[model samples]
Target: MTQPIPPQKIIVHQLGRDYKSATRIVDDILQDPKPGQIRLRNHFAGVNGLFDAMAMQGAIGYIPLTPPFDLGVEAVGLIDAVGEGVKMSVGDAVATTGLGGAYRHYQIIEAAKAYKIPTATPDYLAIVPTGISALVALEQVAMLQAGETVVITAAAGGLGHIWVQLAVNMGCRVIGIAGSDAKCEFVTSLGAERCINYKTNSVADVLGEHYKDAIDVAVDTVGGSIFDALIDNIAPLGRLVVSGYASEIVEGAKPVLAPRIYERLYWKGASVRGFMNALLSEHHRDAATRLFDMMHAGDLHISLDPTVFKGLQALPDAAHHMMSGQNIGKTVLDLRDGV
Candidate 1:
């Protein structure tokens, strides 16, 4: 094989209190892979709005870094340089997830952090980090069971859509809540038993009239009023999984008067649990394996937004687009041409 070359990368020269001002594209020289590291030619990088925003504002408590740091957490690529002691070889396809290595055309990553994949495609961006979150959160945290009824907020989104399909495949009846009629239709097409247009209809009223005391598991990414409504409608021993607070993340958390958690949950023996995929890193490999298997078996489908962002320069705009809630599915930055 021919020798691989270094590539350009995105850097945060100064932290933007918001997404737009945070990042800049720059030419970067990739260092040769160190011992136990493998260099990758990144094909596509995943855009996670919440993480991008928090990372820009220096709110990522777990992996603190000063300015002039790289951004992005996940990507799919082919190995171009394998360092001494690394078992991977040139041209091997892989998916890697770690902070600060993805938004570049080429990445030098620890071999242990990279997983061999069947193909270097943008789809793996959905299957690895995003899909695994759905799998682990529902299976491990919520302990979702077959034949139960699940209600998912933001159910037409990247993560929520995966959850809807997974729940349906597990023999669960799913009620999906989306913001628009188009999104509701999309969620319904994913096999949700019902797709509620939360913008047009009252979630609480609909649940109260038709699904009151019947939701066995509630997965909420949008918090605020939607979360409170789910809390009020959970069945006996139901599990409420709090995966994110997208609403609060963008609009800021607002105060609302609602029944206390003790009042809403204690009477039914139900429980509310919060899940962060980062906290369940140990299971990521297994979860990714399972999700890929499902995808290959035609039991899983990934949705990508119609608009595609290209090159490191598009990162900030992509983040802003996602935060604006205009994306129907996963927002991806395509770097296959190394732009």
Candidate 2:
């Protein structure tokens, strides 16, 4: 028998039952070969809450698939080889988001789905569309205005930290609410004027005492109890944006009532808008490029303090760490360092 050359690939064959469960990475493409696509050599994979939720929910019947699947949304890498009519070269560094299965060493991507990141950008900086999602959710969906007083829950996290900086830069007085004093301090270091310790102090008291009035906007990243608490602090005509529900991932969760929330919104003449960073087509690329421009101009600063897991095996541990709030900043998998 003739020997075939080894192709490095990170494969996720199945989904796990719990948040702590991990995925598997194999050395070959497990799926039946699909026609007309190019295999890409992976570089880096950006991790976020969406990927975690999808994995835990076990394929929600939207993507036309069953269990035992590859699960990753976005990654940055280069095209290794091409199939029929594919024009991209072997060395193009591109960013691919959406259509899960990105956390691998090599995988096939449609040529239209990949956006080429400029050569001048660094890998660490280029792998920042997760932050871009936060920005787009805030600016596009919420429509925050200048000189507004905004409250950002979980303000020290990957998305929350970016929200704080973006709000601050937009002339908003940012009140960052974090789980710990250290996290609060971290948000403050990122230009938040006020950092609230939700664990120690009461949300109502802090908002009333410091803000003296209802806030113009509230960006809730960690929902559940904290989101409920924010309801009492919104100003008339205040806008509330819900991005993630980190608090619900832990045990003993409950559903929030929409009618009551709507009642509160109506009583205060306020608005509660739900937004996720799942935009289609050019919107993702547009947001990413805009954020990069801000990064290049030194106007925006992102905290990359979390641990960088090397290789595909570390992916499971990294996901657990992020889900548990053990990660400080952006948690990403460095796929290029090893297979």
Estimated TM-score for each candidate: 0.94, 0.85
Residue pairs in collision within model 2: 72-101
lDDT of 1 by residue, 1-339 (tens): 545444788777788766457777778886799999999999999998798777877777577878989889999999999999998899999999988889999899999989899899888888779999999999899999999999999888889889999999999999999988998999999999899998899999999898899999999999888888898899999999999998887445777676557988888999999899998999999998899899999999999988889877787788777777677878899987633
lDDT of 2 by residue, 1-339 (tens): 545434444434555554345455556653422345666676777665445565555543345545556666677777777767766677777777655546667777777666666641224333346666777777777788899889998788777888888888898888999878889888999888889888898887778676644788888877876777677678888888877666764342586555667777787788888875654234666777778778768877767645768766676677777776666667677776633
Misplaced by over 4 Å in model 2 are: 1-15, 19-22, 30-38, 59-65, 83-87, 119-128, 249-259, 279-282
Q: Give each model's whole-structure lDDT.
A: 0.88, 0.69
Instruction: List pairs with backbone clashes in candidate 1.
Output: none
TM-score result, candidate 2: 0.85
Q: Ten-residue segment with the worst summed lDDT in candidate 1?
A: 1-10
